[model samples]
Target chain A: MNKHKQVVLDRNKVLSQIQRLAEVAKTDNWQYEYDAQLDELVYGKDFMPRDSFLFNVNGEINLFISPDSSVSGIHIEYFQANYLAHNQELQPALRAITKKTIKNQRDNEAATALEIELSADAFKSLFSKDQLITVL
Target chain B: MPEQEHILKCRDCEGKLVIFHRHNYDIHKKKHPELEDTAFFPDRVRNALKYPTFTIPGNGNSVTCYYVEEFSINGIIKYTKVVLMNKPYIMANEKIHHIMTAHKVGHVQEEKYPGLKKQMYHNGNKI
Candidate 1:
């Protein structure tokens, strides 16, 4: 196959993985919506642009799966307040991390939510770094 | 139709790095007729070599970087090259290597070429 075809196939494989995660979300009652045209699966409705497709794995952790297959990757974003309150010393270091960016902020509180894009393999392993779970 | 080879060299090692390879001139000419006009072609080629753009992942677009090199075969320019530089030590820059690595991973925008982001955005979910 051509290189471009290979890329499309690889993206489809990653999309299948995300589709499995979406199935798990449905069973867990995580509150999700899927737009077939957009290929976007949003998890929470109240958040709209912010909360659209976030899967609240627990009360603390939220997962946002990007709709576009071309950029097929999972974004694991932490609720800013909850993350900082528990881990204070790590905040400065985390803030220093260049790739980590703040997203989905609201007017009510400070923009505490920070997200890091993870590769398909990393997402499959639930963002495990050095055999340690980086995000819960 | 004879095939011509083009090589893009790595500045650090000065090794012949082949980044782009094309064997058909007629198809290339059909794709880029602007390159056929010899009168103003050199200037246009110079401008293209001066401003090479690389696609940024997830941004669905490419941004021009200020580094490039042009290669010619038999007085006919074949391809342009970008030199990867080190911020500190001359050793292989990990950042550039990482970007290249990330690019290998399946995360690029769907658009085939550059400057198509506006049209893709307007299409919206259709793509």
Candidate 2:
């Protein structure tokens, strides 16, 4: 019979892994911020906890790591810019122009926003295999 | 002084209840004075239970409970396990619950607890 043993992680080891991830994020255009009082490490571009990223039009992803080395959650928000006609007559004028033209114009003028939360496992998987190996 | 204890019951199942013992901070502070002001203190577990960010789904009303235990580990004073028992008398997901028990030895192995459901969320939201 084989006996299975659980692997307990060292506190320092866990922190090191999180720091390594943050370092990698820096090269990926993510800024790193640490709160000593909350013991939370956050990395992302214009990221805020539980709030939508309003500053940048680029995709925003926020990763939160708690003091215990557990990942709280990852918040991802994608933003796309769209152009709207300032003149009220533009719609009617475009309709008279061509049906195909309206379709193309609508497609170009559509904005998109997506917000999602990734599970802990999914968040960890985002890290490179090399980074994960040391922590494991 | 006797340690404080709290009894939590499943809102759906009135007869089902679990007893959770509060941590003895005095004893723990003596053992690990360095963690006196940190969240690592055993009392933090109690505080987490009192002010949980989320709860487990139960039949009708939601249920809240803590499954605390103590272990002998280096540089650690105590280990507290908080379990949110839901409807059908199910326990919280092991993977998520283990977050609180990380870096410490568990006095009771998880396998010892049976017939507990996992991944049931209350209020349809999660922290």
Best by lDDT: 2
Worst 10 residues of 1 chain A by lDDT: A1-10
RMSD of each: 19.8, 20.3
**Candidate 2 accuracy as lDDT:** 0.29
TM-score, candidate 1, first chain:
0.26
In Å, residue A63's CA in model 1 sits off its true spot by 14
Q: What is the TM-score of each candidate against the true structure?
A: 0.20, 0.20
Residue pairs with clashing backbones, model 1: A42-A53, A43-A53, A47-A51, A80-A112
Tens digits of per-residue lDDT, candidate 2, A66-93, equal: 2334433232211011111222322332
Q: Which stretches of candidate 2 lie over 4 Å from their true place?
A: A1-136, B1-23, B28-37, B51-108, B116-127
